[model samples]
Target: MTSPITTSSLPEELAPVPATAAPAHAVALVAEVQPFPIAVAGAELEQLAHRLIATRWPHRETAADQGPALDEIRALCDHWATDYDWRRAERFINETGSYRTEIDGMGVHFLHARSPEPDAMPLLLCHGWPGSILEFRHLVGPLTDPVAHGGRAEDAFDVVVPSMPGFGFSDQPVTTGWGASRVADAWIELMRRLGYHDWVAQGGDWGSSVVDAISRRNPAGLRGIHTNLPLVFPTEAEVRDATPDEQRMIAAAQRYRATLDGYAREQATRPQTIGYSLADSPAGLAAWIYTLFQDVTDSGGRPETVIDRDEILDDIMMYWLPNTGASSARLYWEAERDVSGAQVIGAVPAANPVPAGFSIFPGEAVQASRRWVERRYTTVLHYRQHERGGHFAALEQPAALTDDIRTTFRALR
Candidate 1:
């Protein structure tokens, strides 16, 4: 069984988001997108195996199960070091056609796959922390080439999945202010650069926040958006008058904030401080990220029950191979400084005017009733509460997510 975990939950609603603005350090952006494939060297893989084998394990947790169990981690590391195939994961990435380009002084990497159908619409999929572009690896086929995945060609999409800065092959931001808004702006620039004049967007985790920013900007080409984790905070009055179901949602979130959010607190406050362990120790990093899968997935603390062990390893390798432990954690630090840049915890970005769709997974701690979401989105095209799935919806329930995305965009298309 996995330990109970809690992601950062919604707090008292804040002010509406401000208008989009360019970063002070904005520079001449490179007007080109270059091919950037995955090619990890054998020696690097060897080094990772050595590090895993050499990990100095901590003592087992008490029977209370506050975090990943010691025995479970040890076995996972053993398999990771001795039997895991990094090549399979690499093939999963390269097969989709990866590329990178300079946007506002940061190198952003992405996977672009065009659909075979002539009427396919441009679709941008954003992933958050602990999730790389690979999170959407399963959707590329179903969304881009629908006929092959037992779907109609009319539902096909020209999918674009980008590695949020500082996460995957993307370059880490040198200066501060690469917050959620900046990332959203870069995504807009990317779609435009690719000559996709009309497109829709979707995201979860920090990606949801980025999509929120993009919706606020309401660019001419952006037709609408979809989110699995919608960031909707009701008012004090609204809270007081919440329905029985809404009250239950509110209480669960409160419990999450009260006990299960230490990881978020630490990352928001001292990303660099925690970076030392996360960057240096492979085992430490695995346990830290693994807690979420346990706490959040419908698998009831055993993520491998739903997601493949190798696939989980693939997600971890994104952070390990790039040594992005510190860089990716800094996203929270930037947000806490001014309540800006990828803020998920108590952030109050302005309400968006674009039509939006929402899919709330039962395992997700932070949730909103349709009334709650519609108030903010104004034009709610689609809203669903699936009986299964979790925060990592793409990994846990790709088929459901893809179908939801296709369903939502069909109206606009």
Candidate 2:
């Protein structure tokens, strides 16, 4: 009796509900908040499946350590063509009810879930490159409704998870100047519009940098900050007088820059060059993203070793379906140039003004010594070294990360 709404014929109810009204404070700055849902067209999914089937794969790598193994790519692509379910990922976002709001003339997509607890603290979770709102999907329920997730009612948080510009459902930055610092400013404005005067910030990877920037700014509502991947490097003296662990970490960082940082370097310098391939070829996009997952996760050697194949595919789909290859990569260009005056570049970052917490996940890109971290975050309120989990802590060790967040902010709250 009824047919599904095609992408071309999307009804007003399902479309991006425009923001006709703006708060008093928001009027000065152009802003528009709209109710957004995660719904990719059925035809887009069909196209993705077809592209996966028609991939023009490269020859298998002779050196397994150099890149993703052939067998791994083959298996992943096979599943992408057959068993992967984009709807499941879409359903999760739909259930959570995401929204898109214009801040600084750029559209930002975020999930704002409130807790029943009257005294609940506001928590903002920012994700990095290759990570969307999906990174914190599992953590949302536990953070918002602590009682349901085996925590005290007082530990509840009104969580806000925003997709950085050019990532996920958020609109990509049209002009330049949308680096980490600009994004930080946008987050503060977002919370202000939501009527949150005080909140804590958390992130890993690029998210860590953004949180670090926010902490530096010491925005009106920001209480404290936490990061899984603390962006601190050893000082010259510290490096010279390194402990065995510090030495090991320094070596790892050096190796990463020399070898594993090609993708990053390319993105930083020439994202548009690779953008064509990334936007055109589904297989290329998967491989490009999968390589990072394989290298960063705590999974013996491959990302799938620690995380599920389907989970990885879901993350990949976020990039592929949205055609965000170029836009996402442009973040690196913005970071490299410090387009927004708020990027934490170089080896040693400046000290944070606000209080900070560090959850040092073992599989992070590089390990920083307490001395190194203290140099950047003078008031290190809480510090924990996790035995498991990697760069993608929320996906790999949600319970541990969640516990760390709760414990880190208990005093502040």
User: Whose lDDT is greatest here?
Assistant: 1
Model 1 whole-model lDDT (C-alpha atoms): 0.82
Provide backbone clash counts, one per model: 6, 1
Q: Name the 10 consecutive residues with the lowest summed lDDT in model 2.
A: 1-10
lDDT of each: 0.82, 0.80
Q: Taking the tens digit of each residue's C-alpha lDDT, what string does model 2 give over 1-413?
A: 11111122222223443344532212122235555666666677787789889888888887867778777787898899988888898877766656667777776778778787889999999999888788887899999889998899989998889988888767666688888889989898888988888899999989987887888788787899989887776767787899997897788788778878889999999999999999999888888899888878888667876778888888887787767899999999998788445433445656667888888777777777777788877688888887888889999899999999998888898
Tens-place lDDT per residue, model 1, 25-102, is: 122333476555566777888988999998888777887557889988888889899999988988776667656677
Deviation from truth (RMSD, Å), model 2: 5.5
TM per prediction: 0.90, 0.90
Question: What's the residue-level lDDT of 51 in candidate 1?
Answer: 94
